[model samples]
Target: MCCLRRKKNKQGQYQELISVVPSVPGHSAPVIPVSQGFCARHGEIPFSLPPRCVPQNTAVLRDAERQEKEKEGAMKVDAQRDILAHRGSLSVGSWYPVGSVLTGLYSMTPLSEVVAPPLGMATRLCFSVEYRHSSEQLVVSLLRLSNLLPRFHSNMTLVELRLLPDDRRPRQAKARGTGPDPEFNDCLIFQVSAVCVLRSTLSVCVLSVEKDGKRHAVGRVLFPLEGELGQAGRVLWRDLDPEEETQCSELGDVQISLSYSSSLQRLSLVVLGARGLQLLTDAGVCVQVSLQIHTQMVKTKRSCVVEGEQDPIFNYRMTFKLRPQHLDDACLRFELQHPNDNRSEPPALLGVLVLGPFMYARGLQLQHWMDMINKAQEPVRMWHRLGRAI
Candidate 1:
């Protein structure tokens, strides 16, 4: 019998060959007849091989089939490259099958079609100012405030006027109506010099009073008293800028009248009233006044307690003995306190105010001090804003 085996040729290629061997030892094997058929792709077969060797032509056929597959694969790759090259220019409709409905369509709405929440109303104040050259006094007449938005069910609104850089003493008018529009035919007069009329600005603040006596600054306007506006008296309407939440959280105002008598070597402070104070508890509130000289507590006094009144009227007076030489280092501290039921426990502090020289105070506090020193023996009354406790 004979078997077919594969061997490598000198050209490094594998070829199929038939190996002849005897079935019995030392005996010649019988030879079979070779096939005379010829392959259509690989040509004719050798005549020396047996008929069983005819299957060897399958290896050649596999090689020819593999070549044809490689050619077809190369053609397919080139076609895909051409499609990808022009992909950007192709329309979306061409990518999908014809008559197929497109799903999940996305569209954006125009800005004009979008609805937003309506804003609050704009507040306007109508007023006029006239500076008299002969009297050196600037007179401001507040006619009315229109379009005032009510924060609470019952709103009481007031107007505060201040002359900047020259005078910081706040002149407040009585609060008016609970409606959106309130009329205030109030007039405020401030003594000014020629330079003050040209350089100073008039600040008008509109405040809303709540039932709890908490005051919120709704809006404010700063009008420059320069050029034609300060020279000629004309009625003008100005829009008020809305106050921020930080400004509204300020601890109210305290009306204090100060007078320093050099002859008596004494300083008298009258706490007439306080408005817009914030009360956190049902306990009564009192004002604790302390006199500090060179950071040392010299004397301390407390006002009478008022129950259930956030805007309390104390009308209390306290006197401090002070020398003229120590006036520069003297400071007065005021604290709003809630008295505790137990006398042993300390009172709860709400707000504080300090009035001293330029090094210790600024704004209205410093201005108050300078005014007291400038107009000695004369009572200088002003409304001072309170701040949070230390």
Candidate 2:
């Protein structure tokens, strides 16, 4: 059964967390019968514990009594096998499916010739902005909005102005939010340094802000400031588009331990168990965990599959030598497949989890990760969520 815990957030809002526990002894809990198989689309099953088997006695007994005992033993074994089959069906077709910390303004692009306006340069550019129609995918659209909010669609949006070369922090200017094809008669201004007028370029970014105050850039345009900011200021019109959507799915989770060696510059990962798998196979599944470092070239390490078990206990340890400087470019990817040699069919991908050290270091699990890094020699065990390939 699942346990629910509740707590109040800083804003006095209540939130819930769920955890599961084993069945209680001697209690008759509601259970889904093994006869009824699992549903592929909806993985719902009544929770129940399988019955224990009775052992046979060595002492002599009446023929009728012995025969009856043997029959009961067979029945117990069959019941256990039925439960395993049900669990396999559930594993083959179950899915309990269901932010950003910004560091300093860094390089958005990698062209060396580009330079940002010097700090403390005082200059202001005024803009009359509007958001026209956007054909971008819904998911990507939420990411590229002028408002800093995440939503199905945004009505309130604004533009943030930045002077390129990226050494200086960029400032934001907001536009009034409107519905689709929203028009903003409101004017916004950005004050930048004088150097921004010389060799630096102007980057106008469209942002979308939610009621909760989260925002992201929808699209941006780069304008060369060579001589555009002369005596008379100029008004320009621009349009932006969000990038394509990256594919993601709620597959399951894998429990693993991580440790790093500062002196040897090596990282060791211990695969523990992958739970909540939803692979469709009669012979069970295998998991493949790999790590890749992308510096100038890509380096990779792959682990052998944990055969015969859907939710396998690998206890496999893999290590890689990685420099602290190259940590940002590293990625860990996990996959689940059927252990087959038929060669005729490719392995099915049950689910996957891909993590980039740099980006994920700031997540809620940051403390656990930091501890692993700081203690270098100590390994921290954690459960990481799995997702579909992009």
Candidate 3:
């Protein structure tokens, strides 16, 4: 879930940013694409997760899994994709294989591109980006592995979600939420829910929106967990004006941009915002407390230094090498700092993790991932529930 709250500017356009790092985190673990299961259409794609087998002991479960893999018996599963058209006479749609992310690794599909629709096809706007994991066997291998053991069969329900606006309505917000109201407003917030099934041995890397766009800086809002809300993961966003630039001014100047990724529901931020003058302290984000999750693990870097207060948005970044070692399933969580509370200051939530990392089948890769997971101590909790079905 992503939470974004900031004052609107004179031009009705504020700054936004999103960044990507090397080591992957949360359920968005970067995994190799190896399989291709079935072809997908643009409306609603159906898929399923592999079943669970409760082994009495750890050794017993491992042994049974080994034997089942050796037998070569297979489970046939399917997932479909939907093709969507935004404008003009264009052939645009999302592609999917016949299987889940774990099972799909066998067909050798090379992921080489980001996701976007083509240009010229859409009227005044166009975005055709595709992030490819593998070039070959994108879905075929997922078929083979699904047959061998308990795996995940995912049904991807695709939505042609866009940060669209209507001209008939005023695009700007009222003065400090007091003046005349604007007609058309999509402030990038909505009720949402998600379910992930990861009860298997295969792993996949999460391709994030910030990484795909190669964006430099971003605003990260951590959502709160409240049961009555019903929907928690759905999000909406608007593009910032292209004219504004952060020139290291004294009045606070940072270009804020954002990205959305289907794989990782939480918005991953790119750290590179403007550094204000040292005299002015880093302006803390006036946030609404709503962060929720079961903390399986979390690692981040935060240091305070300001070049000037002219820019309130100060950027900091930390890299976390993650791997899920033990799992009932994996979930990501963002927690608020207690000390920041009180002092007329609302606690800021950096992130809320919905999913965690999964590793590959190869021995070397698995070993490396296992090492990373072992470092994170358990007994952590954020808002959990997304991993139950995955």
Candidate 4:
């Protein structure tokens, strides 16, 4: 039987070959069959044998098949690249058929995980409360007290959410108060500053409007944020208390009066005195008053320092020539400070009084001057309460 044999040529490399046959008389060449083996990296594989005459058609056919497979693979890789490029443009919340197929390739990290903790903390703290009203009547039938509202009715009620310690503006959610079993399903969002999460309180106030168009506080609930940060989907019910009210701790009081003259176009601030000052230092206390017109400091006045007295009496008057229309953008600031003999120490802040939009009206003019003062000489004087500085 004929069998393939291994042999080597002058280069001294192993080569597999069919046994040599006798020379043919008509062909004039030795009849030898050559079999080719492929090398992956190099195009052609070299064998340790002398070149023998063979048909080229078989080699050409094998090359054609290899090129066809390479073209098909290149097309598939390009298609995959385009699909990934398009997938990157889609938002996280969006879904597509292609996205479903490529789910394993995309990151599964949530949006909160990639962002800051404060933003995630705010989102986790926000929740919805269901309010079930017990009364459906337009007006309370049992409210017969003279001090109560004339015709108290609640068409709509809103809940105010105040996240404390940072003192950001409160957030509110409203619902229709129509039926006896009306469910508010109101979503309240509160952004808690990260610095105060450990020591903050969440106060919610429920307010309803009366027939006289005045909104009155009906109930309030306060929640302390001890360790309730990670609880996102938990629902808690807080019964509203009609007698509850959100009140700030009393700091101190200052006496002041405001007057505006139309003819002179001047706004006068009369600082009569400050009583019951809650200063921390034993040093004498002095009051510093600054008037800002459109957030620009226009005038500043300091009171005479009282020696060893908490309640400093300084009849200091500061006036500014301001346009009547500027009342919309003007604010009066009063800061209490201790007069320090040591130049190295900064002035200690006792408390501050800020008369903002609630105290003054934007439409303050000669015609609207009646609302400010009942009579010309009698400037409206009141004991202004001091709170934390803005």
TM-scores of all candidate predictions against the true structure: 0.41, 0.34, 0.20, 0.34
RMSD of candidate 2 to the true fold?
36.8
lDDT of each: 0.74, 0.52, 0.26, 0.54
Which structure among the candidates has the greatest TM-score?
A: 1
Q: Give residue 257's error in model 2 in angstroms.
A: 0.7
Model 4 agreement with the true structure over 1-390: per-residue lDDT tens digits: 245666777898877565545345863544333422423343343335688866579988789889999999998877766775775655343233143346676756642343322312110122332222233111100101111122333345555565543433556665434322223444544444444554766666555655565555555556666665445444444444443222223776677767777668777777777666776767787788887876589888787777656567777777777776775566777888887888698778778877644333221111123323333334645455667866
- For residues 92-150, what per-residue lDDT tens digits would candidate 1 score against the true structure? 55343223323335564532233221244567777889888899988898877766775
lDDT of 4: 0.54
Ranking by TM-score: 1, 4, 2, 3
- C-alpha RMSD by candidate, in order: 27.2, 36.8, 38.8, 19.7
Give candidate 4 misplaced runs (Cα > 4 Å).
1-249, 358-377
Of 1 and 3, the candidate ranking higher by lDDT: 1
RMSD of candidate 3 to true structure, Å: 38.8
Ranking under lDDT, best-scoring first?
1, 4, 2, 3
- Please write out the lDDT profile of model 3 over residues 1-390, one tens digit for every residue: 123456578999855442322355645634332233445454443344789867678998888788887665332211221222222223334333332344445674321121122333211111121112333111101000111011111211111121111101111111111111111112222122221111111111111122133212111111122231233222222121112222333322232222223233333332334333222123343211121124433444443433334333434433233222223233323221222536688443332222332321222122222322332331111111111112
